[model samples]
Target: MPAFDPCYTLIVLAGGQGSRMGGCDKGMLTLGQQTFAELLVHRLRCSAAAFNPGYGPVLISANRNQQDYGRIGAQVCADLRPDFQGPLAGLEAALSRASPDLPAVIVPCDMPLLPDNLPAGLLRSVMADQRSVAVLHDGHRRQHLCLALWPQSALFSIRQRLDENQRSVAGWLAGQLVADVTFSEESVGALPFACNINRTSDLAQLPG
Candidate 1:
């Protein structure tokens, strides 16, 4: 596989209300030796370095604890609409701040075991299919927020969707040319690719 360009932006979606996790900031939750945000940013840095020199800094979409998230050395941004307009709002916020011409790989901070191949695999699929988006469909379902790549051009459509009060990420993607990349258990080895920690119990299930 050809090395992916190092210019792609990494948008970490951490702006959720965390209702399922008892109103806690899932991104700030500790997993093993690092916080969810720290671990993700670190893993992505190493993963990107393997294919190229390095990737861009982590642009975290955070509604609260902006100062804490920023302390992790990531550029923290928040949704323009208040009271948690959902992931779409976070996506818009991060995309607007990203380089307008480059594509961005979006992931949720709660999914600590996101595949190392996510960014490169999605990029390749989108390029090969000439689509505007690429996202992981983990066998049974579309893990839209778990992992997805979006071209900067989609920013306009997203903004329009928000204006129309459509907050569903799936609804937004339904209108786009999406390349659905599948990551089977066999393909990901022991790693539970796209698995997320939505509750405190889910955290106990994390791989050691």
Candidate 2:
């Protein structure tokens, strides 16, 4: 793979308890027509194809309803460890489920209006910076928790962090060789991406 190539296995992270949403399946929540995870998968697949049109599989890191997520036309896996330990657990599952050599792009299932250039921009930083992970820096904030790309080389450090009870994704990231790819309205097509629907009422926060 070339250093700047835009090819990667995509991981749609939906393995949360959705405690704020009253234990609902956030990924299965319908926004307009399709569910959140479904919409994200569709948009990402379309955008990636338009960007490079290459071969890369999509993986879903879902804790429950494995069958439901499987229907999305992608491989699905649960957290390697127990509980919804956050995106890091989901990410570990994603890494294990994907081809060993290919790096994977991780995106939360709730961000329906994600940037089209997310994978490319992050992957570019991954290669250029030679870092274990490269994540989105949304101009004013580093969106480090859920959106990013990681290579298999990161598995050891990740496993170590999780084993030591270091569950915070941002906290674990601070200890690794990471890159922050900046994004602005002019660059990413949206400012700060989209607000995650933490509650059912949050649907109103979506664009009209």
Candidate 3:
């Protein structure tokens, strides 16, 4: 993906309580020696500087452990919804805080192996159609909610869907013009970008 306009924000969702991981904060959990959240923030910052230089900003939607991640230097925000609605709610809250004219690229903190080229690919896909939401696909299934580029203009509809008690990311995305950009499994190798570390057993699946 070639460079284009540089007005995009990368929103990292790190607010989950990690119930499956024995209630530990997945973002702060150690993948090896370093915390997963710290690794993600480092990689994202590097990617942004390399691929999307001059990008608007990078924001993180954090909850109780906001200070834990504040050291990363990205803007951190508390969940806007009363309960932990889900990743969509986090995105909605982050979107609400973003500039209306700027686009946003979002990813989850649990995805430790997110593709380095993901931001550029999402931007390319979304730019193909102004009204379309760009997402990542692992060939077989769309990694629909994992990595996405969303326009701030969609905030109203997103909030409306949330108000209606709709929490499905794929479902909400379906209502919009959406496009899937495939990432070759070979390119990512054994590191699965979509492999979320939710439980202790899930950690075993990570490359040692």
Give TM per candidate. Answer: 0.88, 0.86, 0.87
Give the candidate number with the greatest lDDT: 1
Which 10-residue window of candidate 2 scores lowest in summed lDDT? 185-194
Candidate 1 local lDDT, 1-208, one digit each (tens): 7667445677889999899978999999986778888878777643554455435656899998999999887789999888899999999999888876556778899888876667776677655553468878888788888544554567889999999999999999899887788876632333466777887777877766
lDDT of residue 187 for candidate 3: 27
Off by over 4 Å in 2: 1-5, 46-54, 186-192
**Candidate order by decreasing TM-score:** 1, 3, 2
After superposition, candidate 1 runs with Cα above 4 Å error? 1-6, 46-55, 128-131, 147-151, 186-191
Q: Local distance difference test, per candidate?
A: 0.78, 0.75, 0.74
**Alpha-carbon deviation at 77 in model 2, angstroms:** 0.5
* Predicted model with the maximum TM-score: 1
Candidate 1 worst ten-residue window by lDDT: 45-54
Q: Tell how far residue 124 is off in model 1, in angstroms.
A: 0.8
